[model samples]
Target: MHHAFQIADREINVALSRARTGYRLHLGERIVPVDLRTGADGRAWLTLGDAHIEVVVATRGDDVFVHLDGEAHHLRYRHPLDRLAAAAAGHAEDQIRAPMPGSIVSVAVAPGDAVTQGQVLLVMESMKMETTITAPRDGVIATVNYQPGQTFDRDALLLSLEPMETCA
Candidate 1:
């Protein structure tokens, strides 16, 4: 079985072939192998190369709560394949967007603010789900595109960063 999944605007394709238990993933031209095993606790363990991931999935209709690495991730899984894609997308390395339509709950940063990578910049609420937008790099905020109480569409540009200059 082969399938495609989307998470945070990125797409990934997975194929389950020959061996059945072992699968091939086409992640943007990179072919990777995945192995799944069931442990004594009945949890699904995913192995990718030398790294291992333990996953616990709890679902409520289309919404799912996944626990891994001592952290809880709230996601909406429309399709079974999306679970893998969302997991692979992980966190953003650049700008963050509303995974779904949401309202701005708060603005935590301002224009010209110096923010460290991973610092929270704002909170968005949608379908009773609240998600935090964070800085993806160490830089000064060059622009802030929204304010508290405002609403944004998926892929809306919420902020921009000014790269720091090197001291010569």
Candidate 2:
């Protein structure tokens, strides 16, 4: 599996690759071997080429914080579907749509409500199964399109979100 990670402003790919000894990284025309050791205390060590580096890693959701060789790095895990969805949504990550035909069971947010990423926005039932709708990012709600007991088709717009302004 190949995973894309955002470090600062750049996106880097690290793949689970096969090599004669173990896993390797594909960097352009170069294949680099990596040796990694992890500890339960969040401390880790990496040996790349002739250099050995000590690192400490902490994570919260998609955000990762790393202390490596006296420097700190923050990164985010970008999902594969995120870019495709953004392109299809015209770069607007505001619209919340239903995944399938369902009826609203409960609503956890309202118009103008502030929500954090992964926070439950509502619950719905389809085919006798319940699912929770969550906020994709931190934002203020713009509209709640349906109330409890309302039925909607697949891909129906459930809500909209407005980006919250940051304090300068």
Candidate 3:
């Protein structure tokens, strides 16, 4: 599958395909061979050519957080259709929804709570992986519809925010 990701402030195009050995990663202008293994401690070991790197990964909603070699990186993946719809809407979104079916692990906000961009609103576990969902922009939470331990389907409305005027 092909995916577009926003990491830091840069947009990256990645094409992933299964290969006879493991998987092929088409990154930018180069095609690289990729191999993955899970260590006994649960960390992932990714091999690209002769280099071996150990990393921790976590996901929340549409964002991915990777801890690699003691450095932290945040990545956001956007479906092409989502991008197009957002563009057509004429403004960034004020609602946060589940990107996949998951059970709510925790809820960190309530109605009328003020939140900053990137502040975690909840944590959800899906497919045995925990993903933290965060505020997409600075705003006051207008509603929180789920409680801890609730299971929601993909695209289910989890919360809504009344965005700050500057962000609206």
Winning candidate number (lDDT)? 3
What TM-score, to 2 decimals, does candidate 2 have?
0.46
lDDT scores of the candidates, listed in order? 0.65, 0.77, 0.79
lDDT of 3: 0.79
lDDT of 3 by residue, 1-168 (tens): 667799988878687878898888998788888888898888799878667899778899999998888899999998744653353232267777776677999999998888887798999887798988877767888889899989987667888888666434
RMSD of each: 13.1, 11.5, 11.5
Using TM-score as the measure, what is the rank order of every candidate, best first? Answer: 3, 2, 1
lDDT against true structure, model 1:
0.65
**lDDT (10s digit) by residue, model 1, range 37-97:** 7898898887775678997777787666778788887765344323322432433323444
**Candidate 2 deviant stretches above 4 angstroms:** 20-22, 39-43, 91-168
TM-score per candidate, in order?
A: 0.45, 0.46, 0.49
> Candidate 1: which stretches are off by over 4 Å?
1-94, 166-168
Model 3 deviation from the true structure expressed as Cα RMSD, one decimal place: 11.5
